[model samples]
Target: MPRPLPDDLLKLPHRRDVPFAKLTTLGVGGTCRWLFEPTTEGEVQSFVRACVREGLPYKVLGGGSNLVVLDDIEIPVLRLALPKEVIREGTRLSAPASYGHIRLSQDAAKAGLAGLEFAAGIPGTTGGALRMNAGAYGRELVDVLQTFRFLTPEGELVEKRPEPGEFRYRWSFLTGGHVALGYTVALAEGDAEAIAATVAVNMEKRGTSQPLSKRNAGCIFKNPTGSSAGRLIDQAGLKGFRIGDAEVSPEHANFLVNHGHATAAEFAELMATVREKVRAVHGVELEPEVEIWR
Candidate 1:
């Protein structure tokens, strides 16, 4: 028998049987059995501490832009609902992890800040960006990240700069039980018009090359060494490949898109097929950039 949740956890803002398809950008997945949306940092910390104390495992989710859930999640899932406030102190901007990534980039651009220009097209929340070191056009979250605050595995809070080997390509050490709350970015001053123009250009590029009309969890795989994953997949002639409603995007071969009514099983199968085809032809393994939850 499973242990019951702590009494303190039941009072937080939450929902039951929320559809995963609704939460994630891909718009396909099983239901989230327990979706807790804590509106304050104290509520978030309390939930985590309770889980740790009771030997319960939990997952922290943000915008759900980069996740693929294959089955109904039974474990407790927490999504921060911090107030939507952005503060600019000096050349630094701080926001809760729940802040939208692309919107935050646009906000920074509008404020004449320059460092977040690369994040203009990245989806998900700021917390997801920091966790994955999300990047585009050669710049990443780690580049502008000043410092972040997160709950440790043992439910202790810490604020510190990312040390060497902490943040890597689409990966971070803030896994296991650690949950990021918020972070600050170190940006530079730039002309408002110039910053906005740069963001516009980035957005245009993404729209032209990506399969934006279709539902997807952003890029499906990480780029292999010395080459691009999309280029490799395109080269292998896998574009438009389909498994049920899941297809390797005809626009960008690296992206797996969900046509209407696509199933999680189909998505998984499509991903496996693409990986196999790429490995067979190019002898390169394509690691998934999107996190899979089962």
Candidate 2:
């Protein structure tokens, strides 16, 4: 049974019974019983403080690009709705956690910033990218990250440069009760035309290799050491595989696409089967890159 929510939390702007199908990129799963959207940092702090006081556990949701909800989540979920303002100081740019990731990359390119070209095609919020240390084309967010702001589990605010061991391949320390507020990236001044050209090339690569027309939660598994997850799945001959509406994309084996009306259960089964067959044939245990929530 779920515990009653605190009165303080109920006072925040929220929605009820929002379907996860509408919330995630995979477009599958049950409902999110309580979805809190805080329009300001103060409201986010208040929500965190209220949950802490009541000993309640909550989850922070970003752009929902890298998530797969398995069922109805009764606990309160926090999604930032901060003002979309990007602060530029010389070659540095900063934005709230709620700002769109792709939009930020475009903004940087327009400003003649060179470092974010690799992020031009990455989807999700800037905070979510920071949380996952998102990368592409052999570069990562940490490579350009200057500083970041986050709320501690105790609801205290802290802003500082990233430390060693705090971030790694598709992972970060901003888990458990921690919540990212914003981030600053140090970029280099470059020719706007050149920056735009690089960004365009990256986008074109993604357009050709990825299944952008289909609904998917990006890559289903992380690439194992010295091997590509997509290549491995392709070599294992799982491409075009299907169970229900969930299918391993023939275009990119690492991506699992939902052909509308896919169920969470079907996706789960498909993932398990892919893993089993890959391991049986290749002897490599694949790890999931997307965050799974129930």
Candidate 3:
């Protein structure tokens, strides 16, 4: 059995027995035993320090996108609730990790800044995007990322420019116990109307191509080297394939949608079947892009 959380850690703002269904975009999985919401960097540091001192394990949750919880998590979970303030220094804009990804893009457009229009349709918070190095339309967060602040595993804060290998396609070095606090993006000044138009176009493409009506945890698998995962799954005829309430989306095979009452087990089974069939047909093994917490 796991040991109880220390008293200092419990003093943070938190909720008990919160369902994962409410915390994730996939809308499945069991309860989160303890969910801690730290509203400031100091609070976050305190939580991390206390957990480290007690030798207790904990998990950090962002906007809850790109994740699939397979079962109830008993460990204390940290979710930053930092104030959503944006700081602007000329062409650079910075925001707390808790700020919405899409909202930041829109804000950039409103400020007559370009470069973030591709993020207009991306879901989740800035911290989640940073962790995933999220992208769309051949543009990624790293392209415009200038500098970022994060806490080391030991709870020491550091800010610096990204180095090579630190950020890559749909991946980043901000793993293990590193916690992103905020980020600055260098953008080019542009016509507000033009930027808004570009953002709209991207948003429209997302709305049309993705199954917006369904509950999903974004793309289920990462595209292999030069091949698209959606195309491979579709060619393998896995689209619309269902195991219980989980189905490979007919609109986009890369997405697995929940049909109201889908369970985590059903989704896992469906993903496995899809991967197997795709491998059998194409001889290419597929890997999941979404993070799964079992």
Candidate 4:
């Protein structure tokens, strides 16, 4: 039997047997046993503290845009329901980790901020973006990150600036029990109209080059060295390949899409086949960019 949760954690808004297919962008997976949604920082802090004190492990879920859940998760899961609020102090902008990543960019543009244009086309939430050091169009979360607050493995809150070797290409030091609470971005003042225009261009680029019409968990594989992952997969003649309902996106080879009625197992198998084919044809190993939850 599983250990009982503290009253504080149990009191928070939650549901049982929530489907990952409904929670995640991929729209497939088994159910989450316990789904806790804390709407305030204090509640989140309490949740983290309770987990630590009870010797319980938990998973933090953001927008679920970059995750692949393979099976029903029996452990407790926390997905922040904090109010969507953005605070601005001159060039610095602060937002809850639960805030939408793409909406945050739009908010910045509305406030005449320039540095967040790279995030215009990014999916997921700010916390996941920070955890993965998510980047696009030559800029990353680290470039504009000023400071962030996260709970340590012991449930102690810590706030600090980006440190050396802490962030890298599509990766960060925020693994394990660390849970990002909120973060601030250091942006530049620019014409609001121009900022919006830049965002539009980025969004348009994504629509053109990506299979936004189908269900996808963003990029399936990370770029290798100097070359692009999509280009390599396309050159390997793996585009439009399918296994069950999972298919290598014809528009973008690095993306695997679900044409509805797809299962997580099929998606996993399709990815494996694509990787094997890419390796055989290009002699390059592809690393997954999306997180796989088992």
Candidate 5:
């Protein structure tokens, strides 16, 4: 049973029209019913507690780089924009997940810490990265995570140290009903110049392979077993495919970009068409990596 929301909570200025297009990298989506951006962990906890007490449904928002909100519906969205504060204790670093990956990597590099260089090219917050076990060049978040702090649905703060086997290519058990507050990462000593160089190389590769300059989610679909999604898409003749303002990126087959003035409906239609064509030709079902909201 859901409880009635307090009037004051609904009156909060943070709870106002939020354009999803501005929130996401794809630049397509309708307005949300409400939007809340908490700048501190304590405020996040408080906001979560209030929602729980009122039995109000809420969705947690991060960098908004890999999600699609349907233009036809309205929902409450909560954004946790915690301040960046990385503290080092020996080889372990504790910091909020809202800190962008580039910032985290730069901080770690300055401290001569290795193991996070691979994340420098990932354009998302630490929380979003952790949620998807985001990885590239054979390295992942599971490799560096020591522990994490999360808020349960009941608004209780809990600490967890997930085991290695608990994570998969782009998934983990920590997906639903839990909002990541921060994480502790373990790093090893390494040559600062060497680590920086590796990061630079990876970034260059990503720039060449991905449509970073365009409005698009990183990857539309997950890679199938023993194959790459981009390869399959390219083989299926989906590269440069267009529907309205949406098109499968000519630069990267797996990415769908919004050239300009694209709508969420158009993007959805393009995705559907691509999936159907790919499935019909290759006998393979494509699973989307981007989270869709309605």
Candidate 6:
């Protein structure tokens, strides 16, 4: 059994049987045991400290775009949503792990910063992006990351600056029990008109190639070396396949969408099917990009 939660943490506004469907882009999930939305960096650290002190199991949530929480399991959910005071300075931006990446990208663009244009279409937060080294169009977070602040499971705050090559394709060292406080991302200067134009072009391309309006995670699987996951799935004839309300998106075979009211179980099943088919047809294994909670 999990340990009891700290008194201070319990006093916060925590909801029981909280529906995760509304929190996720997929719009499907069961109820969570507890949920807390901390609106400040200090609050995030304190809450994490409390959970650690009490030895309670907790899961950190960000924009909810790349997660699939199982409905049948019961677990505590903590959302570290820092306040809007989190700002992007000249070439550096600091934001809570729970803050949205799209908002950050737009703010940076408006500020005339040029390094994060690749993140304009990502639907997560600074913390999540750092954890996954989220990137697009040949640009990655590691390329712009200056440093990061994280709260250890022991409740201590530490700043980390990884050396070059510490981060690899779609992977980072921040996936452990540490909770991110915020980070300073370096950006270059560019004309606002040029930045806006670039953003527009990227958004248009994403809309044409992805199922942005659908209830789906941006990419279900990571692309393998010199190849794309969507191409592999398409070649395997897995497009338009369905398992319950979950379906392999015909628009992008790598995306699995919730047609109406998909369940986590159904989504998992569909992913397995796609993986099997792709592997059998192409002799390559597909890896999930989205995090699954069971």
- Candidate closest to the true structure, highest lDDT: 2
For each candidate in the order shown, give its overall lDDT on alpha carbons.
0.89, 0.94, 0.93, 0.90, 0.82, 0.81
**Which runs in model 4 stand beyond 4 Å of their true positions?**
1-7
Candidate 1 worst ten-residue window by lDDT = 1-10
lDDT of 2 by residue, 125-179 (tens): 9989999999998999999999999999999999999999999989999999899
Ranking by TM-score: 2, 3, 1, 4, 5, 6
What digit string (tens of lDDT, one per residue) describes model 4 on residues 133-170? 99998899999999999988777889999998999998
lDDT ranking from best to worst? 2, 3, 4, 1, 5, 6
Candidate 6 per-residue lDDT, tens place, 1-294, comes to 655666798767667766788788887788777788777767777777777766666787777888877664455677776765556566787776767788889988898888889999998778888778889999998898888888877778888787876688888766657777778888889888899999999999999999877898779898898999999999999889999899999999988999888888898788889999989999999888888877
What is every candidate's alpha-carbon RMSD to the true fold?
A: 1.3, 0.8, 0.9, 1.4, 2.3, 1.9
Locate the minimum summed-lDDT window of 10 residues in model 4: 1-10
Q: For candidate 1, lDDT tens digit of each residue in 92-195?
A: 99999999998899889888989899998888999888888899888889999999999897888899988899998888898897889899999999999999
Clashing pairs in 2: none
Model 1 Cα RMSD, 1 decimal? 1.3
Q: How close is candidate 1 to the true structure, as a TM-score?
A: 0.96
Clashing pairs in 6: none
User: Higher-lDDT candidate among 4 and 6?
Assistant: 4
Instruction: Tell me the tens digit of each residue's lDDT in model 3 across 13-80.
Output: 99999989999999999899999999999999999999889888788899788999999999988899
lDDT of 5 by residue, 1-294 (tens): 324456655544375666888888888998876787778777777777777776677887788888987763344577777777889999788889788877888888888899999889777788888788888889988899999888887778989897767788888766656788889999999889998899889989988988888898889898888888888888899999898899999999999998988888988898888889889889899999899987
Q: Predicted candidate 4: what Cα RMSD to the true structure? A: 1.4
**lDDT score of model 2?**
0.94
Relative to the unseen true structure, what is the C-alpha lDDT of residue 54 in candidate 3, on a scale of 0 to 100?
84
Instruction: Name model 1 segments beyond 4 Å from true.
Output: 1-3
